[model samples]
Target: MLQDVKSYLGRCFAIKDLGDAAYIFGIKIYRDRSRWLIGLCQSVYNEKILKRYHMENFKRGSIPMQDKLRLSKSQSASTPDELKRMQNVPYASAVGSIMYVVRCTRPDVALAQNITSQFQHNLGDIKRELRVSCYSNAGYLTDADDLKSQTGYVFVLNGGAVDRKSDKKSIFATSSAEAEYIVAFDASNEAV
Candidate 1:
């Protein structure tokens, strides 16, 4: 289905040129000058969320969540839905900010956000785990920009992400093994 709403908005505004969409403040824009192909992105908005959050220099880990991060009592999983659960240990803002980033650019980040958002109300264990240091299941996807765009996935079994991404898979995979091999191939290509 047509997941993106901007195209709907475009029809509403009846915008002729899709060129000026790059610098809408909350969005990121990448344009192929030679090809005159413009790409609109929300990365800037993600960065802005970080700035507004002010967690830019704290500590950037490879994954969004920690290892073996649980939802036991007296932890971030407690409370029906309260913010007092998160006491110290910085980065909730960053976590939330990244949620927005993932919402904009990455769909694989869904699992991470689901696990982290639980702590939105209760983050005690989250803060403690990160401090000492320490992790759900979910999938999230935002409005895709282009037609048949390949979504990026960063597989994370535990809190730490085993993989990170730059681009989406190029070819369509017919099976799970093919998908893994494709990602591996993509990584190898990027490594070169």
Candidate 2:
């Protein structure tokens, strides 16, 4: 396949044989031909993020975002000192680091990452099992400020989550059932 592609594309691409990438960007790639499996991890990337944010030695938490912690645009910097402190907080960078993990190996933290991302412009502070089935869920009017519902879904394969998403519904849901229906639709869309 490589030779055919090389022949078709001529020599402009400058493709080199890297011998089965050990890491791409920050993700560690693993392959087990015996089991017909491939795996990706971001432990090194995670460590860098923790160290960057000075959380390397911090205690672990059961939940990525503590329950009932609501972040809103209202949290945007108000006073001059607050703005200065926010500038030094590296909130966007931290969210971006977590986002890379979310895009790579940790779907369990999708909700937390999504929420953190919403607050990235302002400021704010900030897993996996293998399974094949997906679980879908929704919360009605969960966004305290917007009255929009939220949807969360995870697709697990081989005892680990391979795909996941958590986002606010584009439209407001009048009832919990409608919110659930919207989430189910979103999940099915992802499955397809």
Candidate 3:
């Protein structure tokens, strides 16, 4: 059927068959006809980013971000020397690079991506299972700068993550329970 359509289109327009795609826009593609499965990966792109950032020798961590990690504006460069030092770091560029990976094949890092993006002007370090299930959580008043809660959720499908979000709530929650409720609402909305 694919060949027939290709031939039909070919008759009307100039076209070339490059055969099965192994890579597109830097994401590598893999297929298993016997199992009828297809997969996309960006290991090469990821490695290049690591190399570009001089993190090729850094130790790997089990999680994208440290547990209970909190970032605030106070952590930003304060003094003239600190500001000068931060100017040399490609903070925004690094975050943009990792965000590309997150959007493409790493939903597991969505939370980290969201968190890091909040501090684009401050400069900072850059940093999945499938089950057709979702998990949501909130950190009450986690944003020290605004006293807003942080909400996050991830949806998994077939042992891989399919959707995710991590961001500060637009409204402040009165309690942890309220924060959780908000996150749940957001997750449910996404599920629908």
Candidate 4:
């Protein structure tokens, strides 16, 4: 199949001589033959970022972001002096590097990554909500803005979220039921 693909592409795409794709785009791939398992990681990439930021010896936090933290545009640099200082901070690059790790291996960090990247120029509050029942389990709004509600869902297959979304609902949902419906519809669409 690979040979056929190589022939079809007609040499424009050069297949690297890397021996079974152990690494691709900063992700390290691993395979277990007897267990029939394949795993992906970005530990090396993560370490590189940490080193780049001079945090190689920093203590690890138990949680990436604390729950119930609020971020707003007001927090952005409004003055020219502040903007100049921000330019030297490498905030965007750090967030982007973090995003790549989130995309490749750390699904748990999706919400945090979303909030950070959205406000790359400007962003945090966290809320913890657990589902108690189908009807009663509508948890706290992950988004604090009154204009829109955020909805996130992950479709887990073989222990990974193969298709996942963390985004705002297209329209404002008036009630918890309406929000639930929108989430259901989004999840089902991805399932199909």
Could you tell which candidate, 3 or 4, scores higher by TM-score? 3
The sequence of per-residue lDDT tens digits that candidate 3 reaches over residues 1-192 is 998999999999999999999999999999999999999999999899999999999754333345476788877788888888888998889999999999999998899889888898966332223125789999998988999998999976554566799998899899999999999999998876
Arranged by TM-score, best first: 3, 4, 2, 1
Which should have the higher lDDT, number 3 or number 4?
A: 3
TM-scores, each model vs. reference = 0.41, 0.46, 0.58, 0.47
Q: Regarding lDDT, does 2 or 3 come out ahead?
A: 3
Tens-digit lDDT track for model 1 on 1-192?
343566787778875555445465476678898998876577557556656766556654454555565665465445544444345445566677677667666776788677766655445543444332211111122224422223344444344555556454445555555555555565555333
Quote the positional error of residue 183 for candidate 2 in Å.
Answer: 40
Error of 3 at 6 (Å): 1.6
The collision pairs in model 4 are 68-126, 69-124, 69-125, 69-126, 70-124, 70-125, 71-124
For candidate 3, the per-residue lDDT at 184 reads: 95
Residues 1-192, model 4: lDDT tens digits:
977776776677665644477888878899998999999988898899999988899755324354466777877788888777777777778889898888779888889888777787642222343221111122235567655667767654323334567776668777777777787787776555
Clashes of each: 8, 10, 2, 7
lDDT of each: 0.53, 0.78, 0.84, 0.68
Which 10-residue window of candidate 3 scores lowest in summed lDDT? 123-132
- How does candidate 1 fare on TM-score? 0.41
Is candidate 2 or 3 superior in TM-score? Answer: 3
lDDT (10s digit) by residue, model 2, range 1-192: 977876666676766665678988868999999999999989888888899899999744333344466677776777788778778887778888888788779888899888767877766322233225879999998989999988999876555566789998889898999999988988898877
